[model samples]
Target: MTIKASDLLKYDITPFLFGVLYSRIMPKPTDDSNPKHFYVYTAFRTSKAVLKTAFSLSKYASRLVQQYNSLSGYPNWEIHKSSDNAIDLRLYIQNDLNIDAAQFYNLVYKKLRSSTWLNTATINEDKKYFLRGYMESRGSVDTSLKLFAQDYFYNNRFELKRVQLLTDDIGLPISYANFNPRNMQPQFVSGENKRNAQFRINLFYYAKEIGFINEYKALIFEKAYKPRARIARDGIIYFQISVPNLNSHVAFIKYINFFTNNIYDKVLTPEKVGILRKQIGFNTSQELGQPYRNKSIVDLFDELSEDKCALCGTSQTFKKKANGRQSFEIHHMIPFHNGQEFDNIANFVKLCPTCHRSLKRGSASKDDQIRSIITILGRHPEVFEYTSSALGIEELPKLAEEIWSLLG
Candidate 1:
């Protein structure tokens, strides 16, 4: 509701500082029938860009959490006493008391103006020791990033399969992905397991955060991503996130051009190179994390009732004329050839078993699936054609570059 912080001294801040401040949210009301059931959604300061447009009641709040960390110790912002990470907060609030939107905006703006640091004397001295100690106390890098990723993937947990099929070796293909998750329960890292329990915990928190707001979860990748490496016990773990279906070959060509054009002109960090390569290469499962059927994903779709037939677009209520059986099956809308091109959530759908088998067997064609999607989208036929063309063009160069690198 209300937030205040010291200053936006970027030099003294750490990512962990942001996490700490983000952990707090306005408490949920116990009474379901209460007239004022307003909610506060929490996210990274960077995320303010996205959520600001969606939540309309007008009260908004934010704070900058600063921390310094080192091998010796860190600081804790929660206690507010001062440990290692120097915690300075900037708080802002938007209130909707009159149930009037205009008044709420004024209240929120006024709250932002009032936020200031409580401990001005301590942070001004030295940020390094204070910030370091705070981060150390906050938690491990694994813990922090897991929380961040969990929150990011919270809305469409089902999309986790897409992330896995693209990145993990053990992930299911689009067609087989609709099988009951309860059947595959043994294969996953259960909530009971302690190995990387932080990832699971963060995932649970993420699911709740998205579920609470009743928002549709979707994954959007940046067009270009810089790569970075983390020191593993052996070599290094190079990772990058990018738009999934860019022309791989074209990407490589453009990247080569960009590098030849700009590498020498700027300080090309290992991260930048890493970003270029995340989309390319034979990413071994050993270097990357394993894939498992994410229950979160299943829960997401279950909540949305999105498991309609991928081929015939039939609902579960549909029954077979001959057998009188209910319908519902997972279908890989994209052919196998397109798997490498685009088999993410946008391309997968639930279909009746009869349609699924028919599509696979070629008794019925994917044209049905395409037509259904087109009808649902309600756009010009050329919209699909040109979109596919653009998608193919974008990835060709990147794919070519990858091939050349492999051959060379």
Candidate 2:
């Protein structure tokens, strides 16, 4: 009998089966037409935790198949240690009932990637379980949460995009990064021009949404969410979460305290507070009450150029209207709506009112706008540096194209 899609739900193993299929290495199928036999082989390797999880899953699957189909035997399963000190877990299933292995694999694979399957009602739990299994197989938790698959997989880009869609459907937003071979880790590097498709989500979001099933991963995720504070050798107090690197400056300690206290309890105690206050020679609380001023875009532009338009060199005195103010505007090489992180001095440029208006969306001429953008980026190396870094664009022409699109 052919294995039907409904059998997945009938056996209550849709999520688990999909998880195994979506793993880093998918199941392999072998067929023997002479006697009408089929064999499915699934293998997994990496950590002991994954091995144990996969082993248990394999046994669970075997039991389910036996009970539901009333099979006389269970699927073969084994664990082996490789010469490289890596552990490998393998599961083999023989289907004598004439179930097509290739067809069954494709059916489950399609279900896993189907948008309709994701939107099905009462499947939230199943979705979480599916993600958990996939995470155990291919996910990693560090400063960020990442899920990756080798580039050689058939329709790898489509698969990665499906992952992004699944995460969004599950209410956890994830971003996809195209394969960059040069920056790939040694293990991920292989055949020429081969790379890996990666999906990244914020650690806090991952912890809050779909948590870990592996004991070690759970511990790491727990520790990462806890807040901690420390004093550096330079006499600066650093506040951090998940990783050791400092995220904010000493001036924002009060803000950090507020966040930690409200979210995870105050990480700093009264004793540590006293020590910090004494070392810094000030009450940390006062900084919160004091007004913190960041330089305005106009102010940043003035620092880089005279009180005139950087594009047309129109002096403020000459461009002054009846109100006695220059018509120069501060243009962002990278748009402000992208994020506040790009709201820095390097991304701002002073432009004449005419030049600024010409570069905006729905301008009269696209050529003029492109020329103006190229001129602004070429004149200011810092703007190019900041824009390129912010957008991850390398070449100036490509960066210019990206900026043009952002402007539109």
Candidate 3:
């Protein structure tokens, strides 16, 4: 402060200020071309944005302070204590982490308890991490925030349905399953059986999750249809069965649509198409064609990709390898094998290797499986017909003259 003007000039304030500003603007100097530099720069930028945005929210800031206080008051909570069990330690970690309301609720699935069940030490630990994340912008807050503001609300709703069902002493009903099937009664098993009622409830849950009313209708059909036989072997099997009546084929198509719809279009993308190739591993569908004894069946399916072992209800004799390649396979629905009376497309199915082995030996019967498939397809005749036609089946189940006709 006592130095003369000349001495101050000699000190060069401009250079010193310039150096300070430069250091403030940049990270510690390093190899400019390093790949790690990009990662560091990106992280720094993202963190800075989050901090800038969150700090502006007064609620976030206030929560941050409260969490910090919780941590300081119980500093010993963070230490791993031999006296405490694993559950106690985890709870402490959750508290130290400053997990939000959303995260705490989500922890119910993993921890099997609410925050009320957690010890004071653990709660303190959770609060600390949550606050640290908010203040320092070093960890996550979005997932926790979303959990609190949104997902938790839905969780409560699901719980409500469960509670209502339990309190009413009634099984969950398919009241919301609004499917107007052309041929079949969607609710086929509406009697005094508890298991049947429970099964319907289970289908309702699956239907809700998948977000398709039509599929749910098909599922109802599935529940109504009974399997003729128990599956015995894993090997490929062949089914030579009575072709579905026109009405039955139409119904079957509806069920098949659930599996094959958007199959080529949605599933054959670069991501999923690669999986088909992997599923076909090692053997070409072409290579397996020459070895089959069922020349008529082989001739019928030979034109299509062999990698797809199951065609027209036949199981593949070969395994689906890790590389996605397939080997020798068989077709269940053979044209020559069909009786002179019935030759419908719905008669066919694809079986994998083990299924095929059992079928060639006549260990399995096709009639048994067709009954199950037909029962499921009874609903949604429109979708079912479309699928069967695509598979080169000539006939389908005849539609009723009137609507609301009950089909079983």
Candidate 4:
């Protein structure tokens, strides 16, 4: 049956309809000569469920085109897998219901890039669907919930202010962080020297208000929010090394004077002394000296390796926690949760926090799980041998699959 534009308008789903269209729509060559021939297309690299929701929401826009242009069609949207295996949901819009393709393309698509449009007054009260659509297209969940804007979008202070205002109104106050081009690779910098803007959302308010419309994002959100095991005291203790004569109060002052170029009398206030103590090895109570202890297998591995993440090869020297210790997480290639037998050193892999989070079971995508297994096995082939011996799986692919299943 041909759905009329008027019938679709009666439902008042324009906020969401336009939101998806605005965020995901691709650029097409302009044909100023043919207004009636105006058509719009948008695609998403997302799951089938997200596409289905978009497909349902797009029907309204399709009906608008059908009724206005006097066209008849059962399904106006197309869903297919792209070459890279990502699902693509494409919508073709012609003519207008309340707003036309050109208006949407200009007011939304163009303005989103060149100017600000996401304000409380413009988006109206029912902003959840609109935010969901935008997030589904450009948002990501990791250590933090964030929405990415186009390069230099936040360079305009007015636009940044508007974004802040809008998010504040929704009760999900966001913090903006600019990605400086100097810190990025030269190849990544554009001619305008602009970098992408990131808006970090308040997770607590996001959970209460706008949740994810994409199933994959929802799963990742759950994992990102999941409580993690506290860093073991033994793990922290392993980094502690005793300094010679640091325990002697007189020697401590002498060492401090040497480092401070003998300006200790003038500059070393009690507060400065306390801070320096903590920076060295002193506990909060001003306790001095660390007892020598034998290093564990994990510590040995860390020392023997390049002091970098095994997966991404990022140097741990630069990635430090607030207390001034290097950040690293020990990931089990064959998780011990499957069996305590896999808890040996052969199964262990050092990962940066980001890579570790990406590899979490159940929450991680199948592709990530498989890729990690491949990367780990490539680095330490002994892991495969150990797993084969333990699980009785002979073939590499099959063994990897077994490990993947065990992960879940």
Candidate 5:
């Protein structure tokens, strides 16, 4: 109850935050004498993870948890943590409290979920954020030959028949995904080995309707996602997306390249790009080192700074390139496409290779963060001319004064 609304933004957690309100309440079981119980469960991999979960769980559920204990006159039912032989890497925490769970569960669920912050977050963006909480916790990209390979078609379309929604390893069709995962279990649904085909189809549809799926894949193109689901011969349910019109294998290659290009980042890593290059027989930009700037542009940037780094004041440059001369890198104060018409000296900052590379790593001190960006803008006078538009997030002139006062 002490949790402030603003503090909620510090962590990424979702729907289970709401779903617990709907599903975890159990009332008196045909007898009034029996104490009612409520349960909330979670898994954690590290000590910090466990602590964070405990804090979050208490923040979200503490009010109901307290009211139940107070009314029922029972001692607090603390969170229970344990590890089982069946699952490693995950330590479990379950709160089994004695209370009239059903009575308070509805009250708590409605009150919390109906809060303006949550009620307003009902669309695909909300769903995407909610799902990403899961993905960041446990999802991965499927870059296998089946998903990443060249296109195949059934009827003059770039068809990817049976694109998998979730691999069986992590246990998809879970209740969080709005599916009865139990349906795929051996003792459930008549021991059927496959289920949740509809869920998989919708999963792809959602991924496509949104531009990107997690941080790894994007929908290939507009009007290009057509999905179906089938129980594979191997008894696993697989989602299909084989309806995009692919005139040639070349077009399929282009789609894959575009996806790879967009998702390329330090997290995606150069090694994965190397593997995709070898396996898919195509390239995406180039391996992560540096973007190739024009030779004349680099020379001009170096001259503008008189061979000193605009960022860290580093002037050291080694004669390491094939030519006898040392080198520096030219950086854009604001990316060219966002506001600036083209790359030029007025929009550029000159940083020796060391400062430029170090900034890219992004694990710098606060002073470094502010000082470096300031240095870049100082060198690029054109940025001030378009300060209201550059970088696509222009602060109002009044807002700049407010920031200046705050800093003072």
Candidate 6:
């Protein structure tokens, strides 16, 4: 049955889809076995589009099937990013309803594994009710899909890299990942080091079985990927593989590009978008900002968003949340409310708490803040133009003007 947004509290279908998937894809602080009394319900996106899931919560996010419960408990703070006034929701909820993660995971897995959720609701209202839930950030859907496909064909540990890195003369993943990164050149592993290596190998197999991975790449990956042996710099033998045939590689390439490219724009109708939002509790970049290639983090952030503090040259603090997340929050170079839209990361910085709060405190004069931000951003005035549409920076300080004029 076709669904109507009007009947569904005017909630756009896309954000709802995002909401449902976000709950499943974003990391959960509490687990079924952990016995934690509570979990956080954090959600805040722009009215125009959902913000990138906060970088803070991104690491723990997984592609494995997860149970999602209802939007339980009210949010405590619906504050905007003091930097750009982007919506920010961070609220903790007690396990008041005894919501079971397993049950939620099963329901979501069954519904979303193959777009069956699109048909589960009889009416638009029901779809809205079913799919609509609190959500936070976009997941690793693109990269995760590509990696699963890569493992299916190449049988290598999938590291996040450029499609170009994976592709070949024919733009396919026919190349070997013999050079997968390693920090230490030491040739040996023992104890936890050995255990972690084994775990990662196990993770490769686990990642292959994920329902979403199988749904898209099952045909091309029907044959079990064979790993050939290789000697690593660490003087250890490791499994390696690559696509042997151009045709097979092309097929795999198509599978990856399908997800990496603008599949939503090609496939989704407004009605479909609405249906997905109402049914899945989510929308994607297609509904919000321009379609973005999320798989590649290359050049995603300006130097401002780098780990160390620009102002004090302090390394990122190592404060881990009770939820086991390393603390890293996005901070805008120019204040968002000073006339900026919550734009791309070029204008943002991933900051530790001390500096993040200091810059956000509004104590510094806008002029002084601009000077500090410009320095932190490596004094590149390019972001002014990059974020100009959202930033509407009314005036740059005299120093900033000199840099901007020179850069232009």
Candidate 1, residues 145-171, lDDT tens digits: the string is: 232232211112222222221112211
Using all chains and alpha carbons, the TM-scores for the candidates as numbered come to 0.27, 0.36, 0.18, 0.33, 0.22, 0.23
- Candidates in order have lDDT scores of 0.28, 0.45, 0.25, 0.43, 0.34, 0.31
User: Tens digit of lDDT per residue, candidate 4, span 334-376?
Assistant: 7777765455555667788888887877778887777777777
Candidate 1's TM-score reads 0.27
Better of 1 and 4 by TM-score: 4
**TM-score preference between candidates 5 and 6, better one:** 6
**Backbone clashes in model 5, listed as residue pairs:** 157-245, 157-246, 158-244, 158-245, 158-246, 159-242, 160-242, 162-240
Q: Give each model's clash number.
A: 61, 0, 59, 0, 8, 25
lDDT of 6: 0.31
Q: Please provide, for model 5 over 233-287, each residue's C-alpha lDDT reduced to its tens digit, 9 standing for 90 to 100.
A: 2211233554232123222222222232222121333454344334323434321
Error of 6 at 240 (Å): 53
Prediction 2 TM-score vs. true: 0.36
Best to worst by TM-score, what's the order? Answer: 2, 4, 1, 6, 5, 3
Runs in model 4 with CA error above 4 Å?
Answer: 1-11, 30-76, 80-84, 95-125, 142-165, 168-208, 227-408
Segments of candidate 6 deviating more than 4 angstroms = 1-306, 322-326, 338-341, 365-368, 379-385, 388-408
Ranking by lDDT: 2, 4, 5, 6, 1, 3
Please, what are the lDDT tens digits per residue for candidate 3 over residues 147-214? 10011012222221221221121221223111111111122223222121110112222222221111
lDDT score of residue 323 within candidate 3: 42
| lDDT minimum window of 10 residues, candidate 2 | 174-183
